[model samples]
Target: MIRHLSSLIMDNVSNVKSFVLLGFNDTMNFRVPLFIITLLHYCVILFFNISLVLLIVLDESLHEPMYIFLSSFCINALYGSTGFYPKFLSDLLSSFHHISYEGCMLQAFIMYSFSSCDLSILAVMAFDRYLAICRPLHYHSFMTMRRLSQLVCLSWLTPFCIFSINIPITSRVKLCGINIQRVLCPDWLIVKLACPEVKSNLTLIVYIFHGFFIIWIYTHLIKTCMRSSEDRVKFMQTCVPHLTSLIIFLFVMVFQSIYGRFDSTDSSRIFQNLIAIELLTILPVMNPLIYGFKLTKIRNRILTSVYLNRK
Candidate 1:
């Protein structure tokens, strides 16, 4: 009897070649409108993020550490959005919402890394702001081009390496099911299908540390800014956008986590789908806009270029 049960479990594991995403099952009536709206949303994300990245790259004056970090942030947004939107749009138009095992894993990797990298980059940006505002005299000496390059590389590489380890660990788990409840495959959801015990907590710890560091830096920044009017103005101009982005990011993350953990069957499918895609949709569009409008140099450069081209 035990042997027979083991055989059945092995067969079940072998059968999970692809995962069926059930998030779109209830959207049959709205697929056309949904597709158009999602397409337009994706285009807007691409345009804004790409334009900001280009503006930073083409203009030499914007070559300071802050603008360089902003460019990296926008580029990461583009990377994250591409991983989600194309497959999502295709699934919207098709009857079947199936994703291959490889595709699902890749999507999860891209998304997980993207989020971790986002926090990492934000932490680096906070550090940059701390130096510029709190230690203006020593800012250039400390944040040399080489130091900036190392931080940028660490921001991108560290997350990618961490998630790279996670993907393989998840892949080795013996999955008992092939259906995912959300619009896209997240590693946690995939892990949920594991037939046996799966223990991993490194990513969570690393993320918590990143969050703590950012808050710590900002705490010092606020205290210093409060004492001086010049620092206060600089904080309003440069730091507000970072704070806004951080707030938006934290809000979306908390919302998604709550929904994912306590997701009730009675909840609306539309609401669940929105919650699932909120990170992809909102951050990609908002970050670039926030930075472009908030940063004086980038704002002035954009206006000057536009005015010149029209003439």
Candidate 2:
């Protein structure tokens, strides 16, 4: 019997090309309201992130390393947000919630890659601030435009390649179930559908690597910031925005992980979905604003841009 079941499971895993997402189980009265609110939220995310990107690109005076990082940061927000919003909106309007195997993998990749890239960019920003304050003499030569371009590319591509490896690992898994418990196709929920023995090790390994990388970067950042009042001030001026975005992102992820694992079953589907998506809703809109308002160059450029439009 066991041998027969193993063959059946293997056959199903290889042939399955779609998943039924159960995360959007809502009553008729609430779906339209939820859809409208989500649409507005997506639009707001795009407006703020894109506006910051444009402001950084157009103003020659603001083309320094810090602003360049912030622009990439905004562009990343757009990239990540796009991965989730359109499909979600479509599901909100649809009577059934289903995603093709390839589509789900692509979404999962975008979601995880976006998260990994966010931290990678933040780490690069932290490094930029460190050299600017702690090693000011060499900052210009070290952070030349060409080097910044390389760092930006690294930030974007490294996480992508790292996370993309999960697809094949997942593809090999024999799923005993096809029902995803959430409104979205999150990486973990998909893994949960796999047979009991397939232990989603690849996702866990990538997360561990990302954790070590973040710890190393932040340790150096704190160490350098402790050296002198000037260094501390520089850290405060430049690193604070990056730190804020990191904290908020981590907090949301932690809360969602905890909530989904331990507390979500008793909760309503809508509330559970909210918990799952809190990071998506907040980070894309907030990061650009946090950097734009806190950094003087970006802030001044924004003010000037507004003034010019008014004139």
Best by TM-score: 1
RMSD of each: 4.0, 4.5
Candidate 1 lDDT score relative to the true structure: 0.89
- TM per candidate comes to 0.94, 0.89
Instruction: Give the per-residue lDDT digits (tens) of candidate 1, residues 87-132.
Output: 9999999987778889999999998899888989999999999999
> All models: lDDT?
0.89, 0.79
What is the clash count of model 2? 2
TM-score of candidate 1 to 2 decimals: 0.94
Candidate 1 error regions (>4 Å): 1-11, 197-199
Predicted structure 2: lDDT: 0.79
